[model samples]
Target: MGRGPETAQLSKYFYEGNDISDLPVNLSVVWNGNFIIDNPQNIQAHLYKCSALRESCGLCLKADPRFECGWCVSEKRCSLRQHCPSHESSWMHTSSGNSRCADPKIIKVG
Candidate 1:
């Protein structure tokens, strides 16, 4: 990442776990000159695994071989209930949570 005020801020809170919510919202200055925000619906499929799993382990309350229900129904909740590896807090549960990969602009689709 380019070394600048935005990069510094992103690194400070993102890696250091500093008070991110307290930081200014519009203070970001994109150095890469690219709008890094991603649309939620456009996100990958496996990303929703948590919500899917949490909703229904997909086995009708039984250990169905077809469903093959594992921990936390699926990967999404498994990450959510257990913290997501892709982003901070698996879903930004904390005030200081800030994962550039998991932007809130995403729209959950059915």
Candidate 2:
């Protein structure tokens, strides 16, 4: 589902047991099952954000010390090296315990 301000507002009402309709356009299409957001697979995919969950360089690098996490220097976000859309020059990973992100970059990938 699109995580805009509307989704935030709708989620609040949804989780509170309020009957909801006309979900956010993106969410509405897939939310044809139950009153609550009950699709297990979709919910898991939505909640399990891996790299994106790590908001900053420190948190991103802290995920697995370069094993599963890498920082995208140009984008300024935690991402997986293999899956990162940015250039290879922008990827930073752990080089020994010196694990750091391009000077300040952390070594966490998705």
Which candidate has the highest lDDT of all? Answer: 2
lDDT of 2: 0.51
What digit string (tens of lDDT, one per residue) describes model 2 on residues 8-100?
Answer: 323433222223211332233333243455454453212123354476766666664424566677777766676666647776666434446
Compared with the true structure, what per-residue lDDT tens digits does model 1 show for residues 39-103?
44543211122233233322212322233223332243323334434442234322222322322
Q: Candidate 1: misplaced stretches above 4 Å?
A: 1-8, 11-29, 32-49, 52-54, 59-70, 73-81, 84-110
lDDT of all predictions, in order shown? 0.32, 0.51
TM-score, one value per model: 0.18, 0.38
- Candidate 1: minimum summed lDDT over ten consecutive residues — where? 15-24
Task: Provide the global lDDT of candidate 1 against the true structure.
Answer: 0.32
